[model samples]
Target: MIKAIQNIFSIPELRRRVLFTLCMLAVYRVGCHVPTPGVDAQVLAKFFEGTEGTLLGLVSAFTGGALERMTVFALGIMPYISASIILQLLAVVFEPVERLKNEGEQGRKVLTRWTRYGTIFLSIIQGTGIAIGLQTMRGPAGEFVVPDQGMGFILLTVITLTAGTAFIMWLGEQITERGIGNGISLIIFAGIVANMPAAIVNSVRLLRTGALTPLVGIAVLVLMIAVIMAIVFMERGQRRLPIHYAKRVVGMRNYGGQTSHLPLKVNMSGVIPPIFASSIIMFPATVANLVDVTWVQTLASMMTPDHWLYNVFFVALIIFFCYFYTAVTFNPVDVAENVKKQGGYIPGIRPGKPTADYIDIVLGRLTFAGAIYISAVCVLPTILIGEFGLPFYFGGTSLLIVVGVGMDTASQIEAHLISRSYEGFMKGVTLKGRHG
Candidate 1:
């Protein structure tokens, strides 16, 4: 392990990319501390203290507690993510977008421009809502979040948060272009990890104050290690579908006799399903807060993180998106067509529509199993904390994102090393990239 660490820096290009990624992440964390105008930090923190079950709590987690601090980065990269997802869904349903998708790189640049515009628009809308909501919000001790709330403060807040999000989007693009791993994923990963130290401090404080017992602490530690192991196992797990390439005669020379397998990862959707599910659920919570309807408030109250209704809906959404994302990313028809063109076929399946059908059936089963596993992994931590009284930090969605992103980044680093014919952390063994 130590040698691998040294080997990373031994390669100058890989070392530069890694260092650049780290510097960008440090900038993000610093932005998390710069507060926005017209908000009382103390009152805001106290207000979020009791909102653990609300949508804001989850949003804050992704923002590295920027929401709690009312920082310039309070809105985080979520608006950008939401905008990207919206455009992707539109590409599927809208004809023009579908056509544009076929245009390749140029078309993607056009769509990316559109996504940026959408992000700014969402930032303005959400910033306005949040500004108004803060004015009406009071801490548990009757302290107001915003002392002077008006159009001026609202506009200021909107501009600050919008600019912050836009800068973050630019930063992510830079990282992806010049650094290692997916920039957006790394940003979110950094945010999630930023809270780990504080969570640990809180847990240790609880133990010292007698709020958490030694046995419970030990149990939590054990469970966390177990959960981490499970995540590593599941994330690395894949079902390989064997493919045989028939012998081909080209200019009296034999070719195309090769054996390979298509590997379908267990969590094909990765942390996307949970992230999408959580983001979608936040809409209702945000609406319920902004609009003062009696019935809506009552319904929203029932959808808290601790509520059964919320968990059920959360699980359902995860499963739905699991299948949805898998479908979007992997098209069996295309795969079958490509395979047939290359003279490859599944051992028992025909090389036309039948192969497509076979692949679809296999994918369906994998998707279903993946959905269940993701749902269990995400929701189990909540149950452990709520019912069994575990610590604040547990391996669930956050852990999944952390582990998945870390492995993905490391794999990219390994690829760069291996392509240069240098051994990496995996030694002589090849580390598969995220898509692989």
Candidate 2:
């Protein structure tokens, strides 16, 4: 590992890219600390103390506690992510969007522009909603979260948060274009990771104060390590389908006689299922806070993170999105067609429709198993929090994102090193990405 680190810096371009990515992340962390104007920081913090089961708490996790602090970056890059997901869904159902997807690089550029526009629009709406929500929020001491709630404060907050998100979007683009790894995912990874130290400190403090029993603390530590190991193993696991390419004569030379395997990851959907599940399960609570209906509030209260109903819905949604997102992203028919075009066929499977069918069946089974794994991982943390009262900052979704993103970034870094005639982090072993 030390030699690999040295190798990375030995390559000037790689070093520059790594440094650039670090600088951009530093900027994001800095923005997380810059408070939004007109909000009472103490009151906002106190309000967040009781929002662990609410949408605000979930959003705060992604924003690295910026939302809890009412910072300029309280919105984080969620609106951008929502926009991207919206575009992806549209591409599946909308003809124009599908055509645009099929148009190659130019089409991709157009779609990206559309996503940016959608981000801005969503940011405005979300920012305005947050502003309105703040006006009615009170701390545990009955202090208003917003010191001066007015149209002026609302407009200023909307503008500030919108601009912050726009800036983050730009930073992500820059990192992707000029730095290393995925900018957006890395930004989120950084945010989740930034809170780890605080969580650890709090846990230690609790342990010392006898608030957290040593047995429970040790169990939490063991669970965390075990969970991380499980995640790493599953994320790298793949089902390799054998493929045989028939020998063909091109002019006087034989070509196309080759054997390869198509690798389908155990978790093709990655963290999307958990994220979508969280959002969908938390939607009622978010809406309840906005709407003043009695039944709605009751429904929201019943759907807290610690509630069994919430867990059921959360698991169901995770399973649903695992299949849905996998279907949207991976088309067995397309893969079959591409393989056929290259004169390759899966062993024991006929080319064309049969191949597609076979692949789809395998994928469906894998997706089901993946869904189960994701649900277990995500729900286990909630169980711990509810039953043991542990501070689970490193929740299941956060773990998945951190591990998945770390693997991808390391894979990219390894590729760069190998391309430059340097050894990767591990000798004689290649790191496979999530898609593989």
Candidate 3:
């Protein structure tokens, strides 16, 4: 393992990319500490403390507690993510977007431009709403979150937060182009990890107190690590379908005879389904806070975390999005047609509609398994925590994101190392060890 670590540093390009990614993440963490203007930091912190079960808490979790801090980056990359999701959904309904998607690389560049614009627009709208919400908020100590609430403060917040989000989006693009792994995912990964030390401290405090037993705390820690490892294994798992391409004569030379496999990931949706489901379920609760209606509040209560309705709806949304996102991203019919054009056929499956049908069937089953896997990983732990009164910091959605992203980043690093003739730790530990 140590030799592999040294081997990674021996490859200059991989080392540089890793360093650059780390530096960018450090910058994000720093920004999370820089407070925004026109808000009392203490009051904002207190208000967040009181909002433990609300949508605000969910937002805070995504931001790694930055929202609670009322930092310049309090809004975090969530607005950008939301904007991208909206644009992706719109591409289906909008003719221009659909055409652009089919146009290839050039079209994708154009779509990217639109996503960026949409991100900025969403940041502005969400920032303004948050500023307005702050005006009406009070801390447990009866302190106003926004002491001076007016057009000036609102406009200032709108400009500052929107600019912050735009800058973050730019940073993510830079990382993707010049660094390693995915920039946006890495940003969120950093945020989630930033909370780990605090979570550990809180858990330790709980253990020290009579509130949590040592044995229970230790058991939770071990179980959490085990769950994380299981997630890593499943996320990296794939089903590869073998394909054979027929030999073709091109002039005097024969070409195209080869064997390759199409790899279909078990968890093709990755962490997207849970992220989408959580956001969808939380949106209603967020809106409910803004209204003064009894029925809405009642409805929100029914869907609060740990509630039966919430779990049912959450599971349903995860399953729905697992299929929805898979459909959006992967079209087996298109894959089959392309494979057929290239003179390739899956073993034992006839090349045209049959191949497409076969691929779709496998994908459907995988998607179902994926949906159940995600729900169990995300919801089951939360249910246990609720039912058994386990420590909140060690299980559920936050842990899943942290584990999944960590695994993804590690895999990317391993790829980089292996591609450059450097040894990967996995090589020494398992059959997949790096070759140098």
Candidate 4:
């Protein structure tokens, strides 16, 4: 492992890319501390202490506590994420988008452009809403979060936040193009990781002060390790379906004889299902937080993370999105058609429609199990936090993002090392490709 780390910097291109990614992340962290104008920083911090169960808390986590501080980057990369999901969903229902999907690289570039535009639009909308909400928001002890309530603060906030989001969007795209890993995912991963030291410090403080019992602290540690192991195991798990390509003669040479496997992941949708579910479930609570009405407050309370209704609704949505996102990203029919074009067939399954149906059936079963796994992991932390006062980073979603993004980034590094003929962190070990 030490040698592998040394090998990474041995390649100049890879070294530069890694350093550039780190620099960009540092810039993001800097922005996270630059508070938005007109907000009381202390009051904002105090207000967020009770928001762990709300969508705001989740958003804050992704922003590395920026939302709690009312930083310029408080909005984070969520607007871009929302835009991307919207565009993907649009491709499913809209004819032009469907056609674009078939156009290959050029079409994807076009879609990417639209997604950027959508991101800016969404940022503007969300920024404006947040600005308005901040004007009315209050913290503990009846302190106003926003001291100045006027058009100037609103305009400044909207502009600052939207611009901040745009900058983050550009940073992510740059990292993806010039650096390693999925840029957006890396940014979120960085945020979650940045909070780790503080969470750890707080945990130790609580343990020393007897705020957290030794037994409970030990159990929390054990549960965290267990969950991480389970995640790694399931994320690497796959069902391999054998495929055989018939021998074919092209002129004088025989070319087509080959055997390969279509590997379906246990969790086809990755962390997306839980993320989408969180966003959807948190929307109402975020809006309700702005109003002072009794019914709205009740609704917000009911939707809190520890509530039965919230968990039920959260699980259902996670399951729905597992299938929904899987369908959007993977089409067995397309895979089958491509295989048939290349004269390949799944063993024991007829080519074309039959093969497609077989693939779909297997994917459906895998997706159901995947959904349950995601729900269980995400809900586990809610239980701990409610019962044991566990740290928010100990939550399933944060750990999933941390682990998933770390694996992805490490995989990219592993690929670079392997391509350069250097030994990886482990011999005969390869990270899963995008398809898997």
Candidate 5:
């Protein structure tokens, strides 16, 4: 493990990318503490403390406590994430966006531009709502979170938060272009990881104070590590479909027959479905809390973290989004067409439509299993945390993201080292791909 870390810095380009990523992440963490104007930081923190178990708590976790602090970056990258999800869903219905997605590089650029615009719009909406909510919100001690509860405060907050989100989005793009790993995932991963030390401290304090037993604390730690390893194993899993390309005669040289495999990930959509589902499910509750309407309040209460209704609905939404995202991202028809054009066919399947049907059937089964796995992993943590009052950091979605990203980043680094003739960490291990 130590050697692998050293090897990462041994290559000049990799070292530069790693350093650049770290610098950007440091910048983001720093910004998370820069308070927004007109908010009482102490009062905001108290308000968040009282708001535990609410949708705001979930938002706070994602923002790495920025929302509780009412920082300039309180909005974090969530508005951008919301916009991206919205645009992705729209791409399903909008012919133009769909065309752009299928148009290759230029189309992706256009779609990305549209997503940025949408992010700005979403930031305005979410920021304004949050500011207004803050104006009326009070801490547990009855202190006002926002002193200047007026249009000026709202507008200032709107501008600050929207601009902050836009800046964050730009930073992520820069990381993607000039740094290592995926920019957005790394950003979210950083936020999730940044709070780990505090969580551990709190857990230890609880143990010391007799609020938690040392044995139980140790058990929790062991469970967390086991969960992370499980997530890593699952995320790296895939289903490989064998394909044989028929020999074809060229003008002079023969250049056809070959056997290859199509790799379909066990979790094809990765962590996207859970993230999307959580956001969508929480949005209504967030609005309900902000608006203070009777029906909305009742609805929000019903969806509280540990409720059976909440878990059931949450699981269903997760499954739906898993299939929805998978469908959007992977097209069996396209794969089948490409394969048929290349004279590739599954051993016992006909080319064209039959191949597409067979692929879809296999995909559907794999996706069903994947959805079940994701729901179990994600839902179990939430249930345990809410019911048994465990640390929120040990929850399923967070665990999945941390583990998945770690595996992906490690795999990328392993590939780089192996390409340069170094034995990878798993060189002596079987190192089989997960589901495949």
Candidate 6:
């Protein structure tokens, strides 16, 4: 591992990319501390203290606590994520969008441009809503979060937040083009990871104060390690379907007589399911926070993260999205057609509709198992917080994002090292691509 670290810097290109990514991340972290104008930072922080089970807390986690401090980056990259997801769903529903999706590189560029436009629109809407909501919000001592409540404040906030989000989007794109790993996912991973030191410090403080017993603290540590191991194991899990290529004669040689396996990942949908689930389940709570109504507040309170209703709904939504996203992203019919075009076929299944049907069946079963795994992981943190009273700040959704993004970044690093004839991080180990 030490050698791999050295090797990364040995390659100048890789070193430059790594440094550029770090600098971009530093910029994001710095933005997280820049306060938005016309807001009482202390009061906003105090307001967020009691929102651990609310939608605000969830958003705060993704923002690296920027929302808690009402920073200029309080909106975070969520607007971009929302826009991308919306475009993906449109691709599945709208014929024109679907055609654009199938048009290859040019199509992707157009879609990406549209996604940026959508991100700006969503940022404007969400920024306005947050500005209005902040004006009505109060801390425990009844102090308003936003000191100035007027159309001017709202307009200023909207413009500031929208501009902040746009800048962040540009930063992410620059990192992707000139740096290492996925820019957007790395930004989110950085946000979640930024809170780790605070969580550790809080845990230690609790342990010192005897609020957290040594035994429970040890258990929490063990559980976290176990959960991380399980995540790595499950994320790398795949079902490989054997494919045989028919022999073909070229002008002077024989070709296409080979066997290869198609690897279908267990968690094909990745972190989208849990994210979508969280957003949908937390929508009512967000609305309740924005609109002050006795019945609505009561309903949202009942849907807290620790509540049984919330868990049930959360699990159901995760399962639904796992299958829905998997279907949208992976079309078995397209795969079958491609395989047929390449003169390849699954050993037992005939090439065409039958193969597509078989692949779909296998995918459905895998999606079910993936959904179950995702639900278990996502709900475990809530269970620990609620039942065991553990001050576990890292939720399951954040864990998934962190681990997934970390693995992807590591893989990219490993690829660079190996391409340059250097040993990878896991030298003499079978787990190369699988572990990354």
Give each model a TM-score: 0.91, 0.93, 0.92, 0.92, 0.91, 0.95
Candidates arranged by lDDT, highest first:
6, 2, 4, 1, 3, 5
| Candidate number with the higher TM-score (1 or 6) | 6
Please write out the lDDT profile of model 1 over residues 1-436, one tens digit for every residue: 7877887888898899989989998999999999998898888887777667567888899899988899999999999998987887887779998888889999999998999999999999998888888889987787788899788988899899999999999889989999889999999999999989988999999999999999888988887888788888888988899999999999979988899998888888888899888877765776675577998888888777777888899999999999999898788998999999999999989998999999899899988988998898888877877776777476668989898898999889878876766667865575444444
Candidate 3 wrong stretches, greater than 4 Å: 102-104, 427-436
Tens-digit lDDT track of model 6 for 321-416: 999999988999989999999999999899999999999999999999999999999999898888778887665999999988999999999888
Instruction: Tell me each candidate's RMSD, in Å, in order.
Output: 3.5, 3.4, 2.6, 3.5, 3.7, 2.8
Which portions of model 5 miss their true places by more than 4 Å?
A: 283-288, 291-298, 386-392, 427-436
List residue ranges in candidate 2 displaced over 4 A.
Answer: 213-215, 288-293, 427-436
In angstroms, how far off is 123's CA in candidate 5?
1.4
Model 1: number of backbone collisions: 0
Q: Each model's C-alpha lDDT?
A: 0.86, 0.90, 0.83, 0.88, 0.82, 0.91
* Model 5 error, position 48 (Å): 1.4
Clashing pairs in 6: none
lDDT of 3 by residue, 352-434 (tens): 99999999999999999988988988886668767888875655567777777767777888887667765566755422335
Q: How many steric overlaps does candidate 2 have?
A: 0
lDDT of 1: 0.86
Write the number of the candidate with greater lDDT, choosing between 3 and 6: 6
lDDT of 5 by residue, 244-334 (tens): 9999888887876899999988888777778767876776677774576888888888877777888898899889988988998788999
TM-score of 1: 0.91
